[model samples]
Target chain A: MPKRACYAQDYTGLKILHTLYDSCLKAEIDFLDDHYLLNLIVDEGCIKGAIFLDSHTGEIIQINAKAVVLATGGYGGIYHGYTTNSYGSTGDGIAVVLRAGGAVSDLEFVQFHPTALKRSSILMSESARGEGGYLVNSEGERFIDELKPRDEVARAIFRQEQEGKEVFLDVRHLGEEKLMHLLPQEVALCKLHEHIDPAKALIPIKPVAHYSMGGIEVNSSLEVQGIQGCFAVGECANAKVHGANRLGGNSLLEITSLGRFAGDHAHQYTRSASNKEANSTQRDKDQKAIEAIYAQACTLNFYEKQQALGKLMYEKVGIQRENTQLLQAMEEVRAMQEMKEQMGIADKSPIHNQNLIEYLEFSSALLLAPMIISSALARNESRGAHYKIGFEKQDDKHFAKHHIIQWKREI
Target chain B: MTITILRSHNKQEEAYPLEDKERTLLKALTDIKATQDASLTFSAGCRASVCGTCAVRVNGKEQLACAYKVQDQDVIEPLQYHEVLRDLKVNKSLTKKTLQRSTAWLQTFQEASLTPKDEKFSEKQSDCILCDACYSACPVYAVNPDFLGPFALTRAYRYSSDKREADTKTLVDNVQSNGVWDCILCAECTLACPKGIDPKTDILMLRSLSIEQGYTDPTFVQQSFGFDPNAGF
Candidate 1:
């Protein structure tokens, strides 16, 4: 309890910003253009300077840099109902890297943090359990021990859900004063939004999608495999340090440490680059693709498709998945992709067009969703965040190796 | 079930049968009004606590109308000190204007070299929905409206802490001149914050940052150094 109180005190000192919407998109664009020391253009078999697209004007701004760092976050948004990650995180960097012929490793592994705010799609940080909060079932029974790892807690919650009992976080022992100080946001959310107080009432809770264990594979130097001059960091790049499961407070630590490392490495790499000239022909093709994407975005009935995708993913590929369900999800995603292509328009005007941006995001999400479902199905092992009901046990012999996915040549 | 209501305005009490399976405070109020024109007025939006628009006093404690499900008998009143325009709506323009006066949006730096990693440092502060749940809960705001409160001071600290912002000195100077540094650091703001934004800690950080910038609160420095005017004279 004292440790919990102290942790709450510490959080007060740390200031953080949570990205919700266009900010994530803008941040990616800015980091690629204004901040990066090197822009790596991955095409066919050659790596060169990256061509930048002015998202505002639809013009290609070619830049010559020594190296490129991908600080793009994770793929939690690919899951239908996730508690941890921001909604906008949908594996854009993963798709872009795959498109550029960069090798991706562990594309199937995903981490599901247990103890999301019960009944709501909000994450109750593992810090909560770290702070001495206990998990309880509908019968007011202390069902699971608090200090269990995230993977264990997630599985426990899933079991509880299957048994037809509502799982809740019992923080009533912490008392109102402590609850108010330690978890003011959660306390307020429950009291005001859910009309339940953690100090006096049991919090309705459930496990939801959390973190992506799979990403563009990179080494200690932060360089992506098979692609020269490109580096991936943060949740965007799978450093394999986290292996299958990530520890609490490790994410912030990982982002800061790896982000700086990648930035520094990119700076050094850019400084050493012999080729400083912009490839005009490649730049032109990239420009045309950007324009075509913008045009296609305008006429797309994206929201309807997005909703359908969300529902399908939630039902078929959510927390608990089987081979049959994943196959259905794959079929549905392919059909949706065809519909998305047919609905694509050719409007070239780019005036702060959010619709166009959302369409691009939706397209990226659609492409990435199948990768997750298919990867989930193929892994067929109970390891870390991925739980396969058909193949219940952790099959380390066959599934020990990471699942790698590459884009089909024809697509 | 028969529900009883306690009227605070004229100390009147009434009872009515509640037919609805789930009866909230707002629903109960509607029923009471329908049967009899009880002159109870309050503000509400989203009927959810997310908006922070419908905060009121229920049974001597501050609660949101959109939240706080009503029981059989519940006493409801408006928030204290602020002039209530009607039943429960208080003039929040004063606090809003104070934030504007602080120029909370002014960033000192045009652009700082920030990686996506750098963005994570102050990311939680940016998640502020500006519910003013902290404002209502702050004891300092209740005692001194001009104390710069939690939200405004937190906003000031947010920009000041940003490496990209260039005008940290101006911000520090503005806070030093007033009662901004006089905050007791009771952490009521932290306790009241619904988004987990600890404005109290933000204030402390701002004070430290301010001290680092050579803009120290003269009174605090003098007191700590044991400087007495009478002894000096």
Candidate 2:
């Protein structure tokens, strides 16, 4: 069971953040687009901006800011081919800290949303069920409670999919008028992408990568456990508020409330902090790091390897994981790490070099995959999103306490 | 399947044999980018169409690549009314910048006092993903590059109509000249919206609000409200 039956709700983060970004722009916040973070710049325990690959012009920029916030959403993109995450949610921030020897708790629990479009893995809002809808298997039977815990509902859907049954959300009873009135956005998305009319037809939905319940373990202050001057909130921080499973409706509330809390703390932290690092020195190191990536042998293709890694994670470390598959995932992650070294940059020219940015994303993903597999393996019990078929029971005696990986060694 | 992409650099169409699974145009384009040509570029995010970064010109029609299906011999090109950065990638910042000019931010944010009714009012306008499909499809942008365009005008309506607004006059006054009144309700923007957000309808609504505020346009009157068919000031 999840830590308290968290409220169930659906949200479009980008839409919510549209106003947030509007406010950010109003406050004269500078945005650096197309630049990918290579690594965090930590000097003597406090964070000092980051080193990034300028996607445009390919120069290495050393951003030594007062404070850094790791609100990079979740690592559901780690599932690769099957996920509802945007391409940029590569767990870059979390991966950086973990690689630099930091701690992250509950890293294994990845929440799979009950419904996603079967082909593209685009999200089908949970509001479909909440709005008096029903989930029926191929034979047209409501196999499970629509408003149950996400893990239970997702598992039900997944089990149905395994049994050679296509699962669908039947909202035809709601009629076109109510759907257009109450759930206009989901209706439009369904019609636009899937060509399904929610008012009349069955919307094909399957469990796919949705959210990472586990993140960089942050304390009450929302500061990263071992790392200094880095704050995390939203899906990137493990407050352990959502224990084994997150309640269906409470993700937005957690992020909105906790995100504001983190924002306040980060603001104060930045105000009290002073710039200490010399840019020239950091720039030289950043420049060297960028060159080193290009100087390495160009044998492995980062994009191909990344796609393979995503599919691999989806199969082995996905919704259902066992000891053997987890071990295989660990082995593959190690191999991918080797490939990351000799990653060949396709477009060396820094003018909007997506290749380099994607490579950086893949690097972060490779770093995260091993941690996720190991964390899932260490738990040895089915809890929340980390439900292994072999161990169906939630062993609260040993697994009740949160699992934290104190990453101290650089990978 | 063979896919034809209108390359931005040389302004030429390059054809490639589409390999692998049938996916969204954006996903297919991405696959082509990753394997076929590393330089092939386009902007996309939140493949769910909520982010609205994947707008492009498909068959010379503005469409969200993430939502548009790839067809055989389709002429895929960068979205119109924006500077093309790379293949199928056009700069839509101008559209977003104009939103600032239109004062799209909610000035009166009484979150606690806000009810579900207040939200339902601009529900359609709030659906703008800033994908710029409407902006790209706006023929007004073709004539007046500075036209505040569809999405921005729609956003103006979104913020202007918000009940918490202490005064919508500032928002109203912002979209006066090259903004709301400049919109040509050709319904192209309506057709382009992936979220089914009728920017045309929203623009017309803003025009109505403008008229209420004593703002007038000969084009709007002659086109929308019928300028008495014979009399005009």
Candidate 3:
């Protein structure tokens, strides 16, 4: 097989991130390091700028720009405890886009990587299988094809765990030298996190929420469809390049390629002479909204709801989805949203208040949960990552077009 | 289990008696934040140690919170020699400046093909996560605050060794002042690096490379006998 992607050892993403960050620094770009995005500032469908809360001082600030690009990443963090995303991948940008009356597309197609470290939900890179690793059950039987697509492999592993058998990634045949030479990060991670060296031991693994293929809808030029001067790229924008299922290693390609295009288009948009008025009213509204969150009665703990959301998303709306479970998940998420008024943070410090940030992030995830579940329910076919139990076959005839969800006031 | 965390907000150590369960320091800290104190602030990403945002000092040793297992009577504090944002969260903005100051990336986008053997040469150096563990552990930062710390110099070595890098002269010039020569080579950074990257050796290699470029140690040049700064005799 030909190599689909270029890699710098096992730390490809890290290397790419460092290169980009270095380039930004060398270019003398101004960086607001600890600012947390609060909301977008849009006036008459044209994006003015955004509002952010300085995590250090807890002061709300608004910046007005001619062109705004949302590269804030994906919604995989919505799954919480069962996701391989970062602590801050709470779909805040996607939710903010929706609330600002922008459309979100293909949000139901969430790709679950077949092998995440079972304990910490950390990703075990796909190269494990690419390097001839085997997926074995407790009985040491290879059940499914290890080389299958991500969604199928994830479902097979999910089925095995459902039948009360544990699945493991057996790479012992690869030998210690070969394992270390090929996948050094995997070896170090298994040894340090699980206390099981993969060279000698069977590494326990499971599928977890890894990537969100769906996000804010964008056109060929990577601009958000309805909103002018607004562009969403990377995981935050659904450019329809991946459709329902994204192939492994394609996301990096998408980000690098479309990310550049988004930047270029945004820069071009800024160059055009349009001296627009700043949306100062939205900043005040956002500030009041944040203050309101601080004033809410602390009747329901946000952490409990956040954990419950994770469990609910993983169990019900996860790999094997059905109509009843989808409906149940939808109702539960809506109920949580109804009780949102009672959920408040105990920490009121005007500093790096993680509690407040997490509370805001959870609220964003909560707002997008129904959108995902409803999209899953609307599409009654198993296509790509959306594996509906009753409709396991892809019915392209009915669900061929893009499934888009716009925030409606009547919800 | 008793856990003592250096809380930055109140400038004191706060202890929490936690249940002795199998968990990482990050999970334990998160639990404390959720149930015990909501005012606790820490940074974590990718929980897998790949992102490297969750580094904290565990009993005076730098460890990624997600990678380090929790033990009884474990003490956790923010990384050393940096501005602390809160409990266990330190400002990492210095990493960007140091990397920029070192000119650590390829100077020009010249294309060069590489075989497996070529890639393996600098493979170890490419594994840095910029977690700042090495920066936190280096004693040189305590004195010379402007020394282009371990991770940056290692990155500078990474690019300088790259086959595609056309010019290391500018990069070598950039690291002359507070760059490679400033390293005492204590290897404290090598021990603290969670990714196992050897920055001390990389700095030594940079020093040798500097000599080939007709540059000597600044310390030797500044000595009274080596160079007559007073212009006497």
Candidate 4:
């Protein structure tokens, strides 16, 4: 196969990031590193900049801008340990947008990659199976077609696990030379993390939460509806290009294509829009809310609650869903919100308080969980990633439309 | 298994217990954070090692926390010479500066063509994750903090070697001061790289290119003991 001179094997994403970061530096772009987005300030359907927490000094600062474009990535961290998402992928941006009355679509369609390494939840790429690898069960049988869509393979692996059978990605027959030449990253990951060489032993594998196909709704120009001068792009925005289950490589497509549109539209908006001072009332409200969270008594463990929520979402609202399980999941999610009053941070330092940051991320995840469950429950038929047990067929007649969720609206 | 972590707040090494399980060091740290202590702080992203946010020193060697397997009695610390943000977290704000200082990105362009061999040769140099493992490992920082370091020099080399670069001389000139010629050729950065990116060789290549471009080693010029104006007499 002919390879491009710039292609760096499986590290294309890293290479691109480095290249972009370098380009940004060359362009002399100012970067506020180690800052966390606290809240997006919107008043009268216009963006009024955003609130940020400086992680270095633990200071809340507001930067006023005419337009706000959120490229904050996805919300796959709700599955917690069973996800390939980073710990920071707690859907904070999406949750904040929802709180600001932004409509979110397809919140139920979380993509699950089928071959994440079992112990570590590190993703094993689809090329592993594409290279004639077999998805084998404990009985040494090929239970599911390895080349099926991501959702189907994930559901199949989930069913296998339910039957008390462990799944492994058997690629030993592909030979070591081929793996080294084609899938060096996968081979290296397996050798280092799992301690089992994929060329010799079966790689213990399972489905893991990977990508979120749902996010804050955006139009063709990547502008958020109902909110002027507010735009969302990348994984945080549902441009509707990825309808239910997104195809592989389309995330990058949306990123490059819609990302350009977002930049252009945001630039044009800022040209005509007038900047306003940060809303003092909303800033005070946000500050008081954070202070109240800090002042709460440490009775319930937030980590335990997060763990429980992750388990519930993974089991009920995960690959396979049903009416009763989703309802139970919603009830439990609501209960978590009620239980949030007793949770407080143990790390109260003024600098680099990761505990506070993670707790806030958990709060956002908790806020978004009910929406996901309700969205999953409202769409009765199994379509794409949302697989309900009784409603297994894709019913395009009634439930074919995207399930859009907004604040104070019924699912 | 017990993992000792250097806490940044008090500057003390604290030991945490981990259950005997098959897990990466990142997972163990996360487990400790979730169950044992909520105050434990570290930076991690893209747990499969694509994102280089989780690089840490395990028993005096740089390793990505998400890629290294957990071992008993492993002492983990933040990457050396960086301002520790918290426990096992260091500020990488200077990463962009390094790239800027080296003029790492393609500055000049020309219409050109490349062979498959050129792609194969450039593959190793382009895999840098900007994790700063090489920067943390390089002993050059102990002497000169302004040194452009490994990944930046490698990136400079990556662009200079490209056939599309119209002017590689300026990029080479940019790296002459605090950049390529100062490297001690220690190979520590190469050893520390998680992606197996050989920054030491890249720096050496940059040195040869610098020589080809009529650039002299600044250190050698400063310490020219045998230079005499009357040698021709």
Model 4: residue A90 alpha-carbon error in angstroms: 1.3
**Stretches of candidate 2 above 4 Å error?**
A1-14, A191-195, A278-282, A409-411, B19-22, B109-118, B218-233
Per-residue lDDT of candidate 4, residues A91-117 (tens digit): 999988887777778899999999999
For DockQ, candidate 1 versus 4, the one ahead is 4
- Candidate 2 per-residue lDDT over residues B125-179, each given as its tens digit: 7766778778777788767987887887888788888877777777888888798
The most accurate candidate by lDDT is 3
TM-score comparison, 3 vs 4, better candidate: 3
Query: Who is ahead in TM-score, 2 or 4?
Result: 4
Lowest summed lDDT across 10 adjacent residues in model 2 chain A is found at A1-10
- Candidate 3 at A296: error in angstroms? 2.0
Best by the DockQ measure: 3
- Write one digit per residue (lDDT tens) for candidate 3, span A119-224: 8888888988988999999999999999899999999999999999999999999999998887888888898778898988999998999999999998888888
Per-model TM-score on C-alpha atoms: 0.64, 0.90, 0.97, 0.95
The candidates, ranked best first by DockQ, are 3, 4, 2, 1
Output the better candidate (1/3) by DockQ.
Answer: 3
Please provide, for model 2 over A209-279, each residue's C-alpha lDDT reduced to its tens digit, 9 standing for 90 to 100. 88889988898889887767788888888877888688764677787789889888888898778668635
Instruction: Specify the poorest-scoring 10-residue window by lDDT in model 1 chain B.
Output: B33-42
Q: Where is model 3 chain A poorest over a 10-residue stretch in terms of lDDT? A: A402-411
* Residue pairs in collision within model 4: none
Deviation (Å) of B43 in candidate 4 = 1.3
Given candidate 3, what's the lDDT at residue A232?
Answer: 95
lDDT tens digits by residue: candidate 4, B62-159: 99998788899999999998887788888898755888888898888899887878777777888777888998999999999999999999999999
The lDDT, on a scale of 0 to 1, for candidate 1 is 0.65
